[model samples]
Target: MDTAILPLGTVIRRQADSDEQAIRLWLHGKSAHSQRAYTSDIERLRSFVVRPLPQITLDDLQGFADSLADLAPASQKRTLAAAKSLITFSFKIGYSTFNVGAALTVRKPKNTLAERILSHEDITRIIEREDNPRNHAILRALYETGCRVSELCGLKWRDVQPRDGGLAQVTIFGKGGKTRHVLVSQRLHEELCRLRGSSGTDAPVFPSKSGRALDQPAVFRVIQGAAKGAGIEQRVSPHWFRHAAASHALDNGAPISLVKEQLGHSSLEVTSVYVHARPTDGLFKFLNR
Candidate 1:
């Protein structure tokens, strides 16, 4: 991958015969987002292990997993997964005789649907409070499309098709090089068009002043500030928009299957997290009616 285009903080440190070099080889085809995550996880394992790669044993890996204090369950899982991948690859490539990372097991974390998601009113208030057109558009895109921060940042004007009826479709390139389409609301379509004003199709839809994709941290800071500006007290991450999007769509009667496609999830079960937040089918109300 071109280092120039690599997302911020995803630099591939490939000194010859080093662990970093090995990681670069293993993550060769992964997206920048994936690379950054795995890199952090792998580097964390390095800090935990005192011995060399070949000297590390299964016990060390398990101990590391057990020692993940103060880490979120999702974070714990990814860190272990990364450690396992590194061990497996190191064994494959003769870095070690044993795949120690294989022996480590990660406990699946309970999904907290309510905490990670936003209410429709919350998202609306955040966007409405934002005074900047570009920043407001960014917040709206995250909510409307359920797109990852990287996907939203990577959006280009050419990837959007404005229909005669005013609605627009966006071709989003997601994790693992997969592509999916998201329908933009008429209001959002107009906002995007107004923000895009006369820019060439090749230009980024939300370019930084340097004429490149907006960095993820900047997007995060903007969203966090917007949430505060709108008087939201709960800690909000950019991904909250995506969770909220899935939940809100289903709440509005969008089918589960359609929600799955909108989210580019591989299975309905992955999309089913949104179902946890839905109101009961109103059994009492139905009887009363």
Candidate 2:
């Protein structure tokens, strides 16, 4: 494989790079959660098929999809989707001769991923009950910025820039490698700043207890522990904070457009869930009064 110069003198291996190398390089640019999920899915496919790309046919793909019948429908759908994506990616950058993934379709099941909505009081209790500074900062950043687990984990000290008025610009790399900035409130900024002060600008904003970058599982565990301590009965997931952020923001009268942009949602349709997701005090007060 040979190297090619990207814009600004960045170097990357050319299209002729090995299939495994090419896949790994592409995965590196994805958000951490996606990277982990896709890697595991693709590895499963490799183990199941164990054949050369060009020799693999649509029937082979069908058998793989059929094999996942015992799994949840959503898991089956996502695994098939990831397999398709791998084939598509392989063909796109010369890893394969054609995009066979186009034909490997699995019927998506109705989404049963339960959405856990956290109330403002629940959030307060969770925060107060969190014992450590690092986890406290994680919870706060997750709620305040409405960032995904991947985006929050991807943050670096250099990505945060302090402005004149005690606010901070937090740079986030969202899905599809899209970049966006969110301004942190003074209270949130202080929490981040305290951590930032201890680490180099290039280091992770929230490193793991092992002194390396924090993984998604670590963040999830922290949230779960905090929730248990706060006496929340519902199983709390990391994405719940993001949902709560959008819901609470809308409930408190923030514009949908602004919340949409803040959450890095591609369309209003995705962001619109928060509109009706929150509980309202009175729906017909104006109608009656």
Candidate 3:
């Protein structure tokens, strides 16, 4: 740690003095997913700006943004945002005298939520096509819970408990260390119980053949293979199930607030994207053919 004295007799506490140290301090409390994404984004910035944190100028930031022209808008935005976060943190920690990231404008990215959503029939087909019990449960729980794939992968047997009327409640550890309870149907509950067998409470709800907790990539392959087997030509990922769950629930008249809590959304506006993406009714409905 270091300290700096200003002309006005003000002293600033410095937690980090270099770019690498600043990045580490910035990512200290972030989730694993965020840490990985932000690290990759910072790496992209390093590739463009070959200078120290304090030496980076607005011109360097702008040039880095320009070099991202080859990437998609979303990627560009995310990378720039990560750089901004890092540079901002560096300024806060007295590593840099100026917050150059503040001057760097991040362009808005395209919204492809609608294109990623799958229909009810497609979701059902993919689930039915999976013959493996573990993979089948994974697909069902993903759609049924509307949980992130990371949350599902980290599920533990102790997190699931039998509920009233043969239903079951699952406690999902979501983003930012938030936990939410989701109720599954009786059939799903039974399926999970059967899958649990004699495993201990600390055991993962979904385990690989080696008896370890299933990883995200393996679950992705499970869903992709199932989708292809069901004749879905387009690329399918575990996230599509989450999107489909939100859209389908909203389409069937489920309240947006309920969906928000179930999905662990931080805001109603985040949950409202599904309604906006797939509006069931509009002025076109009243048009006479």
Candidate 4:
């Protein structure tokens, strides 16, 4: 009989019957949104462990759970859940007989109040305060398109289509690498066209000083600058625009499904958060009578 030694990567693959590779492959197969979340969870767990895989003991798992106390209970629980999934998958594939994550317990965190959304007035003030044409377009595009800051930054000129007889739409690649078409108002479309003429089609729709796509921090600064100039004192971020758009759309009688599609939500459960934020009509006054 002849025995052959496997390559290092192949050795790792055969040791656990490719369990780690299976987990990695499975992670990649998930939506981009899920991949990001699971990767973060795995990173946090790796930080908690003192040794590499197969060397990690039950004590390490317990220590990781204990360390999670510093994080909100909800967050801790979610991270643990992610770790558990990975461990379970590893076990199923014969990587290890122990299910460390399965034995771990997570503490529940207190539920905090929901964050406040920007009012129509606040949005108006922010827009009015933006004096620069580019800044104005950025702000308007966020509110009009209901896109995340990342999606906005990734936008290119080719994504926008302006036609004389049809509604203008912008193609957005949202979380999870999901693509959706967002309608742009005629006014916003024209403004975008003007902005595009000045900044070339190949260039990012929202570019930094270096002409690269604007990063998260830059997007935050742009929103902060606009908010400060508008004289609105509320703590604002790019997500506020998404919240505001969802709220406004529901308030204006857009269907829940339409809102979900616009927001790029995969589930109605996620979109329900916006629906819950809808302002109530004066029913209390009538009900009291």
Winning candidate number (TM-score): 3
Candidate 4 per-residue C-alpha lDDT over 1-289 given as tens digits, one digit per residue, 9 for 90 to 100 = 2222333423222234443574685586675557888889888888778455545677887778888878777788888888778876665454655556667766656533245577888898898779888889989999988999888988998888776654588999888779999888888887777777676677898777798888877888889999988887877888889888888888888898988998899988888777665547667877856
Residue-pair clashes, model 1: 0
Q: lDDT rank, highest first?
A: 3, 1, 2, 4
Q: Estimate each model's TM-score.
A: 0.86, 0.77, 0.94, 0.77
The parts of candidate 1 lying over 4 Å away from their true place are: 1-18, 277-289
RMSD (Å) of each candidate, 1 decimal: 7.6, 6.5, 2.1, 5.8
Question: Candidate 2 — worst ten consecutive residues by lDDT sum?
Answer: 4-13
Worst 10 residues of 3 by lDDT: 1-10
Clashing pairs in 1: none
lDDT of 2 at 160: 87
Candidate 3 lDDT, tens digit per residue, 1-289?
5775444676678878577788889999888888999999988888888889778999999999999999988899999988998888787777777777888888788898899999999999999888988888999999999999899989999999999999999999889889999998898888899899999999999998899999888988998999999999989999999999999999999999999999999999999999999987799879997
User: Candidate 2, residue 203: CA error in Å?
Assistant: 4.3
lDDT of 1: 0.83
Off by over 4 Å in 2: 1-28, 31-33, 93-98, 194-200, 209-212, 276-289
Estimate every model's Cα lDDT from 0 to 1: 0.83, 0.81, 0.90, 0.77
Q: Which prediction has more favorable lDDT, 1 or 3? A: 3
Q: Runs in model 3 with CA error above 4 Å? A: 1-11, 286-289
- Top lDDT prediction, candidate number: 3
The residue-by-residue lDDT of candidate 2 on 1-289, one tens digit each, is 6554434565554474566775775676676567878888888777888786545678889888888889888788888898887777666665566567887767969744335778899988998889798899999999988998888888898998988789888999888777888988888789877776668878999998677889888999999999999999888988999888888898889999999899999999988866755546566876866
